[model samples]
Target: MFKLITELKWSPDGCRVETIPKGEHEDLPERAVEIAIQLSILDQSTGGPNTGQQPEQPEQPEQPEQPEQPEQPEQPEQPEQPEQPEQPEQPEQPEQPSKKVKK
Candidate 1:
């Protein structure tokens, strides 16, 4: 029976690392395809697939138009007041009234 093993290959810049086989190069492509399919399934189950997709919207019922209210009429202004009537003004009363003595 033939066995396959994979190893990581780092670039000289160290910015990227890729998976490579230790011996068999031809099997790497097949393994990569399988891994990609598994990742896609995982993404769909976890709702990650819809992260960039538009959200599903619920259907809204149509609303009826509301009737507009009528504006109120402006009120008329009152005439200006004339000179006040002359009243018979009385003298101011003292704080205490004088008491009458009994004989």
Candidate 2:
């Protein structure tokens, strides 16, 4: 893959100049990239691939199977707790009169 060092003004057919941005030109033709490299417009890329896809990872080793755990014995049902008695209501207090503040 070739990486563009600067903006490329290329005219493949001598008709019009196509402005290519400064970046990887993996989508472009290899020959065009080579010409760009010769003109100091591009450089070789250090990426894995230009296919726009991720590389496949190596297969992982299978792990050893774990032994089956023994079933736990069923627990006995707990006895229900008796309901507690309700508390007596407290007597209501009388409201105090508000004092007038002096300016």
Superposed model 1: Cα runs more than 4 Å off: 1-52, 56-59, 76-103
Q: What is the lDDT of residue 47 in candidate 2?
A: 57
Full-model lDDT for every candidate: 0.43, 0.64
Highest TM-score model number = 2
Residue-by-residue lDDT tens digits, candidate 2, 23-72: 76557654455456567675544452433443244334469999999999
Each candidate structure's count of clashing pairs:
0, 0
Candidate 1 per-residue lDDT, tens place, 1-103, comes to: 1122334343334476675444333223433433433333212233333344443543344588788889888878867666896588989886786676877
Count steric clashes of candidate 2: 0
